[model samples]
Target: MRPITAIGFDADDTLWQNEQYYRLTEQSFVDLLGEFAEGAHITERLLEAEKRNLAYYGFGIKGFTLSMIETAIEITGGQVSTDTIAEILEIGRNLLRHPVEKLPHVEETLEALNGEYLLVLITKGDLFDQERKLAQSGLGDFFDAVEIVSDKNATTYRRIFSKLADGPERAMMVGNSLKSDIVPAIAAGSYGVFIPHALTWVVEHVEPPTDAPRFRQIEHLGQLGSVIEAIKAA
Candidate 1:
């Protein structure tokens, strides 16, 4: 393996348990839905609605709020009263105040890795929400550059990577989501290191390729230091 000149990181689960926060808010939405409409049907409708809304709103708070509204209307056949909509909006607003509880050893590990690699933060979601989390987490300073991407597909990664000063060959992407991070990073001619998160959404999965040389796997962010050291040694 070539010595890595720079390293890129995926935000969210890679650095902290982001989806769990979303999941908590989602449960709140589901509970609210039960009062006005079909019970667990909230989950079903939101999933279906987000499948389409993802194109327009991408991922993040705004998109999620829209999904909540759309799901309510879809499940209720437009009979969802204003009261239900108000409750949903209130729940979404409450999420803005959601606490950010980080994964274990994240801060210490990032501190250890910062000086050794040109670290960049690459994440995809609503800019405001992502930025809010980044700011609140106090982890932004560890990265040399911050990229809040609109999507994490192969094409998007390819385009963003080509714009980097180091180029893909000398860069490695370390992240949690196989679909959004590893697969796309590998496709972009970069080395990809997968860090499996404890909690993951179904949408963030990808079938691993049988013949990929540039992909590696680790259990968590703390394991990344060894991979970096090995790359440097080689």
Candidate 2:
């Protein structure tokens, strides 16, 4: 119920077409590795590699490319061909080159809230890739500040909110990932707004904190304004 002084947003699936592209790339990876392993097995192994490599590679297409290569190598017992590796690399490049498509109502919502509140983009991923996506998004100017951090945690939200706005208590975080954007921001004493994306990555999946006073879930970005108003009146 604290006056919302600033708002933080998660960029990936929340703002534009991200997870869907990743899903397509993942299917491409499976197809590329089909000769060495079954599609299901390949997908399972690649997911395992991705999860294991998160600490080493963090997040983004580059890490995903590396994980796919590692999975290929592991599946083939180190006999995977160089050409396949090159193809996998190309898949990552394609992901990087994919045009940014802003979701429905995203521009309108940002335009509506741009001057009314401090809008900060707080997303986590490879800095270059994140920056590239933001630049391509064309929604970059709407944000007052941007924080591309290594991870999202309670501490991360607290630090960002304290420095960029009044504090976490006076800020709200809106994103698709309950794990990365909602839980941590709420834990940091900020309102956590969940905007569901159809193709959210499995790794980011988690139960919603339905009992939390600061937690809210909306069908899409279009419903965000009503949620904000309700939050204000709460």
Candidate 3:
């Protein structure tokens, strides 16, 4: 291993808790739709609408909010009231407030590596919500570059690296999701370090590759410092 020149990070569960909020909102949506709309129809309709909207608008709150609205209309036979729409919009609006609840040791580990490496934030999501989370996180100044991408597949990451950094060898991605964060980065000729989170979404988990060449796993975000150190000394 050589000295790490560029260190990219995955947001959401890596730096802060995100999925739980979505889960809570989803449960609320289900309960509300059942009470006002058709029986148990909103969940299926919302998922389908979200999938279609992701194709058009990509992953983010705008698409999600639209999908939520579309699902409500479908379930209610276009009878959803303005009050109901306002309530749903309110939930989407609150999604942007990160509330500063962070993953364990994310701050200390980022502080440890900021000066030594070219710290960058490489995250994906809705523009408004992702930006709000970054603004709330006081750690934003430590990063030299920030990328809010549409997805974390290998192709997307390759394009991001092409535009942002010079070489893959010196770039290592530190993240929580094995699928979206680790697998794609490693596939793009960069190293990846995986830090498992307790409530990883099913969409973000992948099977461990049998032949991953340069992948590292850590118990928590605090261990990232040691991983970088070991990589540096190698």
- In angstroms, the error of model 2 at 190 is 0.3
After superposing candidate 2 on the true structure, give the runs of residues whose Cα lies further than 4 Å from its correct spot. Answer: none
Q: Write the candidate numbers in order of decreasing lDDT.
A: 2, 3, 1
Candidate 1 lDDT by residue in tens digits, 1-234 = 446767888888888667887788789888876766665677877888888888899888878888999988877788988998998888887767776677777898889878777788899887887788889999989988899988887776666666764677778888888898889888888889988876777778777653798888887777878877776776
Which stretches in model 1 have alpha-carbon errors above 4 Å? Answer: 35-38
Return the lDDT, model 3, position 30: 82
How much is the lDDT of residue 50 in candidate 1? 81
TM-score of each: 0.92, 0.97, 0.88
Measured on C-alpha atoms, candidate 1 has an lDDT of 0.81
Model 3, 61-97: lDDT tens per residue?
Answer: 7788888998889888899899989989988777766
**Candidate 3: where is the Cα deviation over 4 Å?**
1-3, 36-41
Scored by lDDT, model 3 comes in at 0.81
Whichever of 1 and 2 has more lDDT, that candidate is 2
Model 2 lDDT at residue 116: 91
Candidate with the greatest TM-score versus the true structure: 2
Candidate 2 per-residue lDDT over residues 1-234, each given as its tens digit: 358989999999899889888889999988888888889999899899999999998988888999989998999999999998899999989998888888889999999999899999999988988899899889999999999998999999999999999999999999999999999999999999999988889999999999999999998898999988887786
